[model samples]
Target: MDLVTLTVDVVIALWVVAVVVGIVRAIKARPPRLAPLPEQIRNRFEVGWERISGRFLYEPQWAVGEADSLVMSLLSARGQPLDHARLPREMQQARHDAAAAANGRPRDKTEAMRQVLLQYRTVFERNLGPKPRRTAPVPRREVA
Candidate 1:
């Protein structure tokens, strides 16, 4: 529109942008408590809500659990035919055989299946580890 109107609008927009950026930077920096009202208040406004929600939500958690299950199933094979429960068991066996054809060396069928499983194993290896033992030291004898 007119120059006066556009300049006022530009000033207001600049002020709004400055406020937003200042707020974000304050949250990230966690400014000193000695500062005055607004800046001090801004320091407490931490932001990681999205990341916290992502890990806890149903779909993400379920997918992570499935990756864990796949790893467990593969490790159980350990280069042998897994004694899987029957029914689509025959079909799964055939699928493993077909996949072996694609690999340069013809892998043992179980190893072929385990390779598929290694994708999930990598996830388990990265994310989870065994719990530490609660080892208490034995009491020292008081010599006579």
Candidate 2:
């Protein structure tokens, strides 16, 4: 075979190898599918979320910290990436805001805490499923 033809064949082979390696790397980089949490665990997280949300009005800073912790716990329970660098953008931002609020860095710490709560809420809803609906108590009939 001519030198030029041999070189061309070698280049094609190298390109094919590179493509296959890239595909393999991409597949390995993807996160594994997360299994659904058990019903009891999910309910516990829901109750925790409610308490954290309720505390937000009275103690914004403390509530933000609790919310952050709860979110991290939920993610951990769900086998999610826990590293700050690997966490989703929204979660990263929420963590940042929570830290800021806890450290009293922001001028409007309450507002910052509120945003953090909202971001964490999104994460909670996504991972723990939607918040359960609360039905109003039915009125009792008067005795005749």
Candidate 2 per-residue C-alpha lDDT over 26-100 given as tens digits, one digit per residue, 9 for 90 to 100: 886676566678778989998999999998889887787888889889988888878876676788888877777
- Score residue 142 of candidate 2 by CA lDDT: 100
Residue ranges of candidate 2 with Cα displaced over 4 Å? 100-106, 130-144
Per-residue error for 56 in candidate 1, Å, reads 30
What total of clashing residue pairs does each candidate reach?
Answer: 0, 0
* Least accurate 10 contiguous residues by lDDT in model 1: 40-49
- Stretches of candidate 1 off by over 4 Å are 1-113
| Model 1 agreement with the true structure over 92-131: per-residue lDDT tens digits | 4434543553453543533444443444444334323343
Worst 10 residues of 2 by lDDT: 125-134
Native-referenced Cα lDDT, model 1 = 0.42
State which candidate has the highest TM-score.
2
For model 2 the local lDDT of residue 114 reads: 89
lDDT of each: 0.42, 0.83
